[model samples]
Target: MKELQDKISKKLGFGCMRLPVRGEEMEQIDDELFCKMIDTFLAQGFNYFDTAYPYHKECSEAAIKRCLVERYDREQFLLADKMPIWLVKEPSDLNKVFETQLKRCGVTYFDAYLLHAMNKDRIRDAEEKGAFAFFQQMKQEGKIRHFGFSFHDKADVLDQILTNHPEFEFVQLQINYYDWDSEAVEAGKCYETAVKHKIPVIVMEPVKGGTLANLAEEPASFLKELHADVSLASYAVRYAASLENVIVVLSGMSDLEQMEDNISYMREFCPLSEKEKNAIAKAVEELKRFPTIACTKCRYCVDGCPKQILIPELFESYNMTAQFGESPATTRLYRKAIKDRGTAADCIRCGKCEAQCPQHLEIRKLLEQVSEMFG
Candidate 1:
């Protein structure tokens, strides 16, 4: 276990969720730019690349295969993929999905394989369908080097999963300064629980899907005043990396510029200084003054929305209006988000989105607010 931990000790990883896309089409990856970003990430001594079955409208796996797997030696990078447990209807579906993932990524084995997006109900479904045993079987066959799950629940739920499945090698968690102590995310409590279980953690959404990076003026100014040079995103990533139990902090770099900025600080990683920690605390307090929707833009809600609403994008536009006040720019953003898609006013209030939301957001109610603001 210690030897395996040493192999992935580099604190930075490349997340393939938000690859640079052409225009508004999520499926159309900008391959030239993505390849360049991958090259830079590799050159900076980072190896871990995280992708999932549903990232990039289910195209991220193949994109990684072409850009990274086909272009470089297998040993040059560590690839992690997740089994979409939501797609499993029976035990046999596990092998079927796993085989499809192997083919999609064009890899014989995965460095890490996780049960994607495990929560209370999903955990129960996975266990009942023998998903845990399947992972162990894959590990024994050398198809998976490390087996675990990415979680989206409170601390007690995490504690339950770890207790029930002690065989899991690690866990991927959503950890950012904003959500660290949040009642919905319980990131601080979740991290503590994983530590108690002796489980190494791979952090996702360290910047809260660009929320912490693009803070409201007051908090953003406070952080900038503390460190004149560093990017706002770097502080959030560093905060997650600073934790003792974290194995890697995954940044979903959309372009070369973001990748370069992340590499600059993460290459020679440093924990937050005492003053920096206090500064983050103050910033968090300042952030609370603005009542923005706490959407991380995971896009989990979009896949199942009956109206096909771009829920996260609309919330982002709404947040811009809430934080910086409405303007032509914010109105244009809202229009762009709903362009050729379902607008906020088109929502049917069916509640599919609310069921899948990890943050447990009142998405229906929030969409009404978005409609009122931008209608």
Candidate 2:
């Protein structure tokens, strides 16, 4: 574990996916705020940063160039980039995409480069395009120090990938307390698979894209009961970091406050106690009581929505109603959520949103339910 920590500055990695934005437009990143966050992050000795091609509609990489890469020396931090294999139309498209990423980030080489968001479908496409060999060749050429892949598939797929390509030094995974037992995500099973293959794991979504951090009362209360001092977000992050196989826990902190809080807990790392672990397990059960929509609010559904229905916003309101019981304020918020945008009832059942969703949610049915409840 110490060996892994030595490779990077700290266990906490700054994920660039959800950087501070100027307004409703995600592409318009708040550079001043982002720079402060980056400064604090580096000042505190945390170096690792993870970004991908599709984050913030391709602006995230450029934002990193402005807020991070341009400000800091190359040796000051280790940047982890990804190859968007899904974007490749043909084999030659790989070179174009990688070159674009380099130009966007204004960097010659990435410290850690990954095959981004490799699910079964993307993996199949990557194989067809010989992406695995391309990444290896890049590593051989000293373009990428550590060549790995960020995964988003079943244990069997992970197992297959590891079995076939034992050369990958590490694997990035979505591991959190909420999804540990999730049948759909199978976070625990996937972690176990990575451990079985002797691959060091880099954890993403430790806070479940800010879901676990903003817990609905029951789970929050459980953590508070255990240790009132620590932030609720700390437990989620600590759980991921505590695992021996997990080298870095990537937290998508949007502002300075979030960075400060994370750094406070992680600067001097402490693993969760046995009692806290049990409490977390119980808290997971408490969370299961509410049939809340499992949307990570990645907004993959929003970009192409024909009706322009703010799917994540509606789901948040719906989750509030489900977890806290329906209240007048919640209703008012739900109304406001659907005000300017198309209401849940406006969904034409095109299934575009559902098709794009990473969680594979029955979005149409969920939207129908939201309409029924809030109508």
Candidate 3:
């Protein structure tokens, strides 16, 4: 266990969920730019790269193959992947998907493997499907070196999972200052639960899917007054990394510029000072004044929407209007979000989206608000 932990000693991990894309298409990865970003990330001695089955419409694994795995020596980096247990229809589907992920990434073994996006319902599904046993088997066979799960849902659900499955070595959580005490995310409670179980945490959405990075005017200005030059995103990432139990902070950098910006601060990592902590506290309160949708753009709700509503993009448009007030740019963004997809008014209220949402957002009701605002 100590040996494996040594391999992933770095605090910053390259999240492949939002890799640079061509135009607006999710799967259209720009190989040239992606290669440059990876080269720079590794050149700076940051070696961990995380990917999953469903990222980028299922193209992320292959992109990693071409950009990282095939280009760099296997021992040069630590790779992490997740099993989409929800897609496991039967027992055999487990090995089938694992083997496919291996082939997709062109790797014989993964440094870290996780049960993706686990919640209370999915926890039951994992137990009934023998996912835990499968993970043990994979570890023994050298197919996986470390095993855990990425979590969503409440802290109580997290506590239950950790209590029930102490074998899990670590947990990936959605942790950021903005959502730290949020009733919806409950990041603070969840972090404490993981610590209580002695499981180290790997933080995802540390910037709240770029929400904290691009703060609304008041919070942004408040943070700037304290640290005039630092990026707003850096404060959020450092906040997560400051936690003693957290092993790594994953940033879904979409371009070379974003990657460089992250590496600039994280290269010589520093925990937040007393004043910085106080600044973040003030910023969080200021941000809560705006009635913006707390969508992290995870896009989990979009996959099951029967109307094929571009849920996250629409929410982004709504947040812009809510924060900055109505403007031509907001109107254009809303139009672009609805183009070739279901509009907010077209929702059938089938509840599939709400069921799948990690934030437990009242998405149907939120869509109604979006419709009224944009219509």
Candidate 4:
């Protein structure tokens, strides 16, 4: 595994989920910008790219094929793709999807392939469909070099999965500081489970989907005082990278500035110091003081909301006012966000939003709070 780590050489991997888009359209990926970012990433000596079936509304794989696979030599970079196990209807659907993934990525074989976004229900579905055995056979057939699964379940489920199928070479996990000790995500325990099984860890959501990157003023200020130079995001990425078993930390770089910022710090990789960790601890303590919404801005709730509330944006405004006391400004922002859609008070308690939320938040209740605060 250590030799495998040395083979890749760089600790950063370009995540394809949030590729730079042209204007407000996600499907229309900015190819020129993406090409530039990839060029810089390669120039700075990173060699890993991770994409999935559903990222960018199913466009991420094809974009990487055009921007990366077509431009760079196959040996110059390693590509990691995934099977959308949830989309599989039966066991035979697995191979059909794998073939499509390869075709979409313009590759004969993937360097790494994963079972995308597994929880207990999804994993069980995969098991019933014999998806795990399918990947193992694919490995034997030289279709995939490394076979693994990206997890979104609890520690106990992770333990069961690893114990039941130890063939997985690596486990991609969400491992940011905010969710490190979160009872909901159980990130800390999940990481520990992977380590216990000697599975090499590949980190996803190291910035908590940009939540840790764009910190609230209080914690950001504390970190600024300590480092004075590093971006708030650097601390989060570095913290994930510093862990012993983490082989790659994926960041979904959105623009040239973000790409350069990531390259600047990650080009010369360094671990977080004890003093920096202490600062993060203090920031966490301070963050706990606010009645802030614990939203990662994943926008999962938005897809199912009948009222079309811009839930994440509203929560951001709520946070700005409630946590940082930027009320007037946040009030204005809130009004603007709700201009074309439903306000916090407009939620009809349909229960669809809560059902879809990965965080299991009482979104109905939270919306009532947002209404009280800003309505």
Per-residue CA lDDT of model 1 for 17-73, tens digit only, reads 999998878899998999999898888798999999999999999999999999999
TM-score on alpha carbons, each prediction: 0.98, 0.95, 0.98, 0.92
Q: Comparing 2 and 4 by lDDT, which wins?
A: 2
Higher-TM-score candidate among 2 and 3? 3
The TM-score of predicted model 3 comes to: 0.98
User: What C-alpha lDDT values do all the predictions have?
Assistant: 0.92, 0.88, 0.92, 0.86
Ranking by lDDT: 3, 1, 2, 4
State the lDDT of candidate 2 residue by residue for 66-167, as single tens digits.
Answer: 989999898898888999886899989998999899999999998888888888888889889988778878878878788889887788889999898888
Q: Give per-residue CA lDDT, model 3, range 1-375, as digits (tens).
A: 556667874789999999888898889999889999999999998989999999999999999999999999999999999999999998889999999999999999999999999999998998988888988999999999999999998999999898888899999999999998899899999999988888889999999999898887788887899878889999999999999998889999998878888998899888999999999999999999999999999998898899999999999999999999889999899999999999999999999999988888999999999999988
Which residue pairs collide in model 3, if any?
A: none
lDDT for model 4 comes to: 0.86
Q: Lowest-lDDT window of 10 residues in candidate 2?
A: 1-10
Tens digit per residue, CA lDDT, model 4, 155-175: 999999999887888899988
Q: List the residue pairs that clash in candidate 1.
A: none
Candidate 1 has its poorest 10 consecutive residues by lDDT at 1-10
Off by over 4 Å in 3: none
TM-score result, candidate 1: 0.98
- Tell me how candidate 1 scores on lDDT: 0.92
Lowest-sum lDDT 10-residue window in model 3: 1-10
